[model samples]
Target: MRAIQITEFGGPEVLRLTELPEPAPQPGRLLIDVDSAGVNYADTHTVENSYLAASSLPMVPGAEVVGRTADGRRVVALTDNGGYAEKALAAEHLAHDVPDGVADGQALALVIQGVTAWHLLRTCARLAEGESVVVHAAAGGTGSLAVQLAKEFGAGRVIATASTEEKRALALELGADVAVDASPEDLTDRLVEANGGRKVDAVLEMTGGPVFDASLAALAPFGRLVAYGMASRVPPTPIEPARLMGRSRSVIGFWLAHCLGRPGMYHEPLDELLAMTADGRLRPLIGAVHPLSEAARAHEDLRARRTTGKLVLDVRA
Candidate 1:
């Protein structure tokens, strides 16, 4: 099997494509013939040795994949590691069937990003109908899905923020009621205008650091801020209690991996979310497709923000 391996963690240049022995399935695990894999900021963080959970040296760093099980059934899975390859072994319980009409790349895109959006809206934030929300990185994988999920859940207005105009436009296409450039100094003002001068009930925050404070400020009274990722490369900053007290706001941190570890906590949401995609209420966008051999290039594109929507690596290509 051909896989991208990190003999040492340092930079994107360290990812090397090499041949490895094929893996076999254990009693409770299934060996999958990977068709596509999802690349995320977490994979970038892991390559740089900055992820919450440190990976072993010479590791293959992919978390989500869409492929076929040992029995040849199409499925999506969250692999702990070792997904940037032609084949991967995953626990049976961690895999879910891919719907009939979904393509491999699209299915892979949805498993991680889509599930995150679903959990954030339905569980973490408890988003309500006719409420307003502000989604950061609205052009990216999870952001795009989050926008649709928020609208499907009955958000009266969805305000999406992106670093570039192209990204903003993509967000609007995906279902955001309004889209704004996120680089300006007065994000709160822009968000207010987008929402007709109304404060947002929830802010789906993926870019952390300074954006955290701004997201907090943009919230309505009793609003919830869900911090999911720190794509900005800034260290996590502390928020003062007074900030929360001022608006009676709440900030909650979410990591899809944590939820995956506790299957009982996320099973229902995952089922409903997959159903939404299967039924056509939701769709996962495949922004770019790269051959598995060009895994490093995929990582580079993601870090540079050169790609929007979901970036998938074609393991079979």
Candidate 2:
């Protein structure tokens, strides 16, 4: 099998395309002939050994795959083995059947980004209908989905923040009531202004550092902010419990990987996401599609923030 292997922890340059033996079958895991793989910001961290979870050497650097099991079921799965290859291994429990009419890249999006988006609004944020929402990095995969999902779930106001005007426009088209530049220095004020001069009731914040701090300040009383990823690669300042107590605000942390331990938590939302996509209620923007060999370049574009929507690798290409 040809895979993008990282023998040492480093940058995108270290993702080398090389030949490797097919994974030996294991209990509760299924071998897949991958058609496409999702490229994520987390994969960038995985290659550098800076991800939340530790990594082993000479490993592939993908987390999700849309492919087929031996019985020929077309499925999308969170792979236990690396996904940047023609073949990979997916834990059976983590794999789900791709609905008819859903594309491979679309199915791939539902696995990680989709589920995260769903849980951020419906679970962690505990968003109530007619409440306001702010989705940071709103042009990216998870952010884009979060923007749409917030509105779908009955948010009265949806504010989207992105780095560029083009991205902001895309967010508006995806159902956001307002779109603003995600400038950390002015983010808090902009978020409040965009919400018609009111603080947001919920926020899906992934960027760390100043972005996180600013979002924290732009929350309404009893507001909830769900922190899922730190695409900026910077950690936020520690929160003072006293500060939260005064406003009755809450900061909640979420990680999709932790949900893998309980299959229902991972599958229920995924099933809803897949149905939404298949029925066209949800539209997943497909970004750049790179061949298997260009995995490194894909990582470069992702880390440089040069792309939007879902990034995919055509494994069979």
Best by TM-score: 2
lDDT of 1 by residue, 116-137 (tens): 8988888889998899999999
**Could you list the CA RMSD of all candidates, in the order they appear?**
1.5, 0.9
Q: What are the TM-scores, per candidate, against the unseen true structure? A: 0.96, 0.98
- Looking at model 2, the pairs that clash are none
Maximum-lDDT candidate: 2
Relative to the true structure, how large is the alpha-carbon lDDT of every model? 0.85, 0.90
Question: What lDDT does candidate 2 reach at residue 79?
Answer: 82
The reply for model 2, stretches above 4 Å from the true place, is none
